[model samples]
Target: MKEFHDIAWYVKALSKELPNDIRNPAPQRLLGGLAYIIVIVACIVAMNKFDINLVEKLMFSLVLGFSFASMGLLGHEILHGTVVRTPWLRNLLGGIAFAPLSVSSRLWIKWHNTTHHAHTQDEEKDPDAWISLEQLVKSPKIVRWVYRLPLGFRAFVSFVSLSFTFSMHTMRMFFMYINEFKSKKLVVWLEMLIPWAVWFGLLFYVGFNKWVFMYVIPLLIGNFIVMAYISTNHRLNPLVPINDPLANSLSVTVPKFIDVLNFNFSYHVEHHMFPGINPKHYPLIKAKILEHWPERYFHMSLVKALITLWKTPRVYYKETEFLDPRENTAYDSLGNGLDINNIKFKKLKSV
Candidate 1:
C-alpha cells in the first residue's frame, strides 16, 4: 500500500507540472452556461407546448433527469469557483443551476465543501463515508431488505436513497435554524424556499400528472444519477484518518459524453487533490496522475463499477473487503468471496 509520503511527493510534483492556464476560460464558462440553460428551457417548453402522450412524456422525463443532472454538476463547478472568477457571480450561477434540484448552494457547501471534502473517508464525519458492517448487522429487517435488493433494484435504491437523504437533511437543518434570524441563514432559507414555491404554483396550474411527468419523476431520477456518482466513487474504500486523496478517493473512467454531462465528476481524485482546478483541465491532471502512479491509481467505467457495487456488499468489513451483514458473509468489490466471520468485530464502529 502507498503511504502518505508517496502521495505527498506526487502532489508536490503535480503542482509544479500543472499549467498556468489551469483555470477555465471566460468564453468556455459562458458557452457552457448558456448551453445548460437552453437545454433546461427547451425541456420545459416542450412539456408546456406539446400535447405529448404519457409514453413520450415518460421518455422526456428521463431526458429531463439527465438535463437536470448536467446542470447540477455544472453548479458544483460554479460553487467550486473553478468555472468563473467573481465570487458573487459564481454563487449566483450556482443558485440558478441548482434551483431545478431545489438544493440550496449554502446548504450544499456546508455539507459538501466543509464536511465531506475535509473528511472524505472518515466514517464518523463524512456523510458520504462507507457504511459500517456492524451497523448494517443491527439494522431492522426491512432496512436490511432494502439494502439487499436485487442488483438492478439496488442501483435504483442507491439513487432514491440520496434523494431522500438530502431532502431530509435540509428539512432537519431548516427547522433546527428556524429561530435564528441571521442574514446568511435567512438568505439560505429563502433560497431553499424559492424552488418549491415555483414548483407548487406550477403544480396548481399544470395539474398533478403533468407536474409528475415533467418535474417530480425527472427530479427524483436526476437526484439518483447524482447519487449514483457519489455512491460508486468511493465504494469499498478504506475509512482512513489521513487526508490523502489518492488513498481514499476512487475516480471512475467515464466516456466523454458522461464526462461532459457530469462536468468531469469521474475525475474525482483530481478534483479532490486540487479543489481549485476546473473540469476542463481534469484530463491533464489525470495524465499527471497516470504518469506517476500508472497501475496503482483506481478507475473504472461508470456502468460496470455501479454493477460491481450492486453485486458486492455495501458494509465495510476490512480494508479491502465488505460484509453482507444479512448473510454474515464477506466479499471484495469484484464480488469475490471471503470468510470474514472469524474477523473480530471489536474494532468495528457504527456507521
Candidate 2:
C-alpha cells in the first residue's frame, strides 16, 4: 500500500506523461450530451403527440427517466468545466442539464468538488462516505430487517430507498445550504427555482397524471440510477482517512455501452486521480496507470462489485473493516467474513 504513500509525486509523473493536447474531447461530450437531450425531448413529444397505449406510455416514461439521469451526469461534467471553456456557458449548460433532477450546480460544486473530492475517504469529512450503524440502534424491527438483508435482497432495498427517498432528501439539502447566506447563493437559488417553476407550470398545463408519468416518475428513476452507479464508486474501499485515490477509489469494469451512457464514469479511480481530465480520456489514463503501477492498479467487474457492496454493511467498525450490524460482527475491507470476538480494531489510527 505504500506504493501510493507518495501520491503527489506519482500524480505529477502521470501528468507529465499525458499529451499536451490532452483535454476533454469535444465529440464525446457533444454527442453524448445531445443524445441524452434528444431522448428526453423525444419522450416528451411522443407522449404529447401520440395516442399511445398504457404499456407504450410506461416504456417511454422509463426511457425519459434514464435520459434525465444521463443529463445529470452531463451536468457533473459541465460543473467541472470539462464541457466548454467559458465558465458562464458551462454554468448555463449545467442549469439545463440538471434541471430535470432539480439539483443546483453551485451547491453540488461546493459539496462535491470541494468536500467529497478533497476528503474522499475521510469518515468525518466526506459526506458521501459510510455513516455509523449506531444511527440505527433504535430502529424499528422492520427497519432493522431491511438493514440486515443479504446481497440480493439488499440490492432491491437500495433501489427503493435511493429512488423513492433520496431524491427528495437531496433537494432539501440544496434548500438548507441556500439558507447559509453566501454571496453566490442567489445563483443556486435561481438555478433551483427556474427549472422547477417551468416544470410545475408545464405540469399544471398538462393534466396531473400526465405530469406524474412524464416528470415525477422519471425524476425518481433518474435519481435512483445515479445513486446505484454512485454507490459502487467508493463504497467498497477501506474506511480510511487518507486521500490516496489508488487505495480509496474503485474502477468498475462495465460494458462499453454503459461507459458511453454514463460518460465513462465507471473509471472512478482514474476520475478521482485526475478530476480535471475528461472521462472520455480515462482509457488513456488507465493505460498509464497500469503501465506505471501495474501491481497497485485495481479494478473489479461491475456485477461482482455491486454484489460485494450489497452484502457488506456500510458502517465502518474500523478504518479497515465494515460492520455487519445484524450479526454484530466485523468483516475485513475486502468483504471477507470474520468473527467479531477475534477482531481487535484498535490498531486503526484513522478510527
Candidate 3:
C-alpha cells in the first residue's frame, strides 16, 4: 500500500495545469451578495402581506427554498474574495448572508478557507470526503439506516439540517480559536446573547407567533435548501485518499438555467482547483479545462451524477498510512500561510 505522502506528487502535478485567471469581478460579486439579501427580504415581506391561500404559501415556500439554498453559492463567492475588494466588507456581508442560514462567517473562514481548501480531499484532513459505509455498518443500526437513504432525499434532509450542522461546527471552531488566543470567552457569550436579543425584540415588536412565522420558519426552509444544494455538489462521489483531493471531488455539468441559479457551483472540479476563482468565471474555466484536459476531468450531467450516487453500492474509504510526515506538513503549511491580505480581485484577460 502506498503511503499518503507518496500521493502528494500526483496531486501537485494535477493542480499545476490549473489556469490562473479563475476569479470573478469584484463588483459583480458585491451585487450578487446584495441580491440574495434583497430576495430574502422581499420573500419575507411578500409572505407576511399576501395572506396567501395554502397553495400560494407552498409556492412562496418553494421560491424561498430555492433562493435561500442558492445563497450558499453567493456566500462561497464572497469567501473567495470575488464578491468584494475589502476583507471587512466581505466579512460583514458574508456574516449577514450566513446569519439567517445559521452559519458563521468567521468559522466558515477557518474550516473552508483554511482547512478544506488547503487539504482538498484527504479523508484525514478534508472533512468533505465521503465516509465508507463499511465503517457505518460496524456501528449502530440507526446509523446504518440513516446513511442508506436515497441520494437525493438524503441530500435534501442534510440540506434542511445545515443551520444546526454549521452552528455546531462553528461553535467548535470558535472555541478552538479562542483557546489558541487563551483569551477571555466574551465573544461566544456575545454571540449567544445577540440571537436572544433579536428574538425578544421581534417577539415584543411583533407577536411571538408572528416572529416564529416570519423569521424562524423562513430561516428553516432556507437552510434546508442551502444544505441540499451543497450536498448535491460533492457528497455522492467515491471516497479517495486524503492526498487525492481532486479524485474525491466531482463536478456536475448543469444546464444553463440551474447554473445561473447555482452560480456555477456545479463546476466542482474547477472550483476546487482554483477556489479563489469566482463563480462567474467557473463556466469559462470549465470550458477551458474541458478543452485542454477532457480525459482528466469528470464531466457528468447533474441528473446523471445524482443517479450515479443513488446507485453506488457503497461509499468507499481508502485507508493509507502516512510514511512521510514532511509531505503532510507541506500540504498543511500550503494553506496555513495564505496571504489573505493579497487575495484581492485582479483582472485576467483569459483562462
TM-score of candidate 3 relative to the true fold: 0.70
Question: TM per model?
Answer: 0.84, 0.86, 0.70
lDDT of each: 0.71, 0.74, 0.55
Give the alpha carbon lDDT tens digit for every residue of 1-351 in model 2. Answer: 433443476678798899887765353486777888888878887787778888887888899888888888888877777767677777787777888888777887777787788898787688677665554555677876776766346656765777855467567568656776388878888888888898898787877867877898888888878876788788777755468887788888888998888888789888888877788888999999999877666588877776666556677665666766545666566323322224332223232
Candidate 1: list runs displaced more than 4 Å.
5-10, 24-27, 134-183, 333-351
Q: Give the candidates in order of lDDT, highest first.
A: 2, 1, 3
How many Å off is the CA of 227 in candidate 2?
1.2
- Put down candidate 3 lDDT per residue, 86-132, tens digits, no spaces: 87777667766555554556556766777776776555566554454
State candidate 2's TM-score.
0.86
- Give me the candidate number with maximum lDDT: 2
lDDT of 1 by residue, 1-351 (tens): 436433456567888888777755433765665787787678777887899988889888898888787788888888887877686777778888887788777777776777778888776788667677656668798877776655456656665587555456556655654455366887888878998898788899888978897788878888778777877767746666576777777788777887876778888878888777787788899899899877556777777666666566677765556765445565554222322222222223333
Off-target runs (Cα >4 Å) in candidate 2 are 1-7, 24-28, 133-156, 179-181, 334-351
Give candidate 1's whole-model lDDT.
Answer: 0.71
Highest TM-score, which number? 2
